[model samples]
Target: MRAYIVPMARSLTVALAQYVPLNGPDEVEVLRSSAAEMCSAAPGLDLIVFPEIHLCGDGDDAPDTNEWLNAAAEPLAGPRQRALCRVAADLGVWLIPGSVPELGDDGRVYNTAIVVDRRGDLVAYYRKVFPWRPHETWAPGHDFTVFDIPGIGRGGLSICYDAWFPESTRSLAWMGAEFVVNVVKTTGSDRAQERILARANAITNQVFMLSVNAAGPVGAGGSLVSDPEGTVIADLPSDEPGLAIVEIDLDDVTRVRQHGTEGLNRMWSQMLPGDPLIDLPVYSGHIDPATWRPRGQS
Candidate 1:
């Protein structure tokens, strides 16, 4: 496979806003307040990330299942979204307002993450491809999206449960994403596992990974950033609402991919015809039965 050369920045500063979301009428206000805090904390940061579903609180223990969540959803041109854009422009910083419950044109709700540039323009968006199974009601997204940050290289977006599948991060890396940002709203116990997965994805893909999680009883708040070498460079406390800032050099991604063992570039270049194990005939209704079995258990 041929490798694409993406623009690299010397160094980029990023901030993760870890905060508990408020329910009821004041939810958007609370979110904007958190954004203000983040902007105040890191005035010169290149990028700032918020938690998933920050607009409407994660409907874990809330009332009215489908109706409430769908009601909370809004179009990309809605007032709430415009407010977020305004925040980015006012702060003069790139922002990922995290994932929101978007009411699509097909009348279905999707967990969508939106990216805004410093001028408050909608740059790109990625819907959550993998929703928390059985529990989440939002529709799943089908495509992987990546976007470039003018002076900060390329970045990809994932939401909450998408981090569990290594393929999500790998696909982004394969598309020349130098950094992956995962915005999440998970319970306290699941936070550790998510962090571990974030670090693993970073090292395996040779890209920086930023996992920004929500705070409070609804969320675990273990927001963290992992470098290309899988090192946790910045971490926020689980119980409290706070901000964590870290400076990352985009060149680190190039360094690791070129120098690390069996580097990603080399591995991709060496792929044979059947190297990837995709779907089997049995699973796709091509095979009848008894064709495959456990390795040792005939």
Candidate 2:
């Protein structure tokens, strides 16, 4: 006798904090205080996300990128960052406090995003792989990052300019990410394009795209959240500071990938083991048909 099993729903509650930072010595303290207030207001939040470079100013007014980095950059696990970890533990919520200028061991500054678990532990960190060239001076990281959220789902991390490259989200999706958290600090007019990119990335990857940006006085604040089928569920379309609380069902990713996108396209299922490898001269790499699936699969 064959048995039918019911699949469990994978749901996650997230808060996108599109707040303007003080950009002073008390910035970290402000972050903690604001997070506490947010948690108090919206109880039982699974994750709280901030914008890119929330600790430091967005550098829109800074005349020199190098000078700004020199003034604001701090080492990984610096005292300020370590202090911020307590916010997650105290609130019992996972936190992505945005990217920071990290002074690396090699004496170079990298724009790095950190992930803190509910237990107040720094779980993972991803450096911006695609720094906005000619303008951004931070060193680029070479690897993609994705972290598991215990029983809920796995999440990919990408910083501001990283979303411009399709490969960033694609690589993360292939690595078994059910959702991607893209922290942005775009004070430019290009934010409209970024919103489109956010939806496109979500549709193409069959994963939720949570693109959070900083509010005005610093950033343009066009943060948005897209579902697996490229639907914009929540959008904050102004420079004003606000918080967006969204509940996402991670199992929807599995549903969309298994079936077709709107029952028409099954992009991930196209590649088969029997098919030959497709060569790509630009990257000097080829796609292996046998192992094109997400990480940890046969």
Best by TM-score: 2
The residue ranges of model 1 lying beyond 4 angstroms of the native Cα positions read 1-9, 24-26, 58-61, 261-298
Please tell me which predicted candidate would have the highest lDDT against the true structure: 2
Q: Looking at model 2, report the run of 10 residues with the lowest lDDT sum.
A: 1-10
Candidate 2 at 260: error in angstroms?
1.3
Candidate 2 residue runs with Cα over 4 Å from true position: 1-6, 58-65, 296-298
lDDT of 1 by residue, 1-298 (tens): 5465555557888888887765667665666676677777767778888888876764555676556778888898888888888878887888887888898888889999999998999999888999998888789999888988875688889898999998799878877888899999887597888889999999777789999988876788888888988888998856588888899888877766655533444333343444444455653643213322111111
How do the residues 1-298 of candidate 2 rate in per-residue lDDT, one tens digit apiece? 5333437989999999997755676787888888888888888889999999887763545787567865678887788678878888888999999988888889888999999999999999999999998878888999999999999999999998889999999999999999999999898899999999999999998999999998987788999999999999989999899899999999888878877688667778889768999998899999998778877433
Residue 246 alpha-carbon offset, candidate 1, angstroms: 0.8
Model 1 pairs whose backbones collide: none
lDDT of each: 0.79, 0.88
TM-score of 2: 0.95
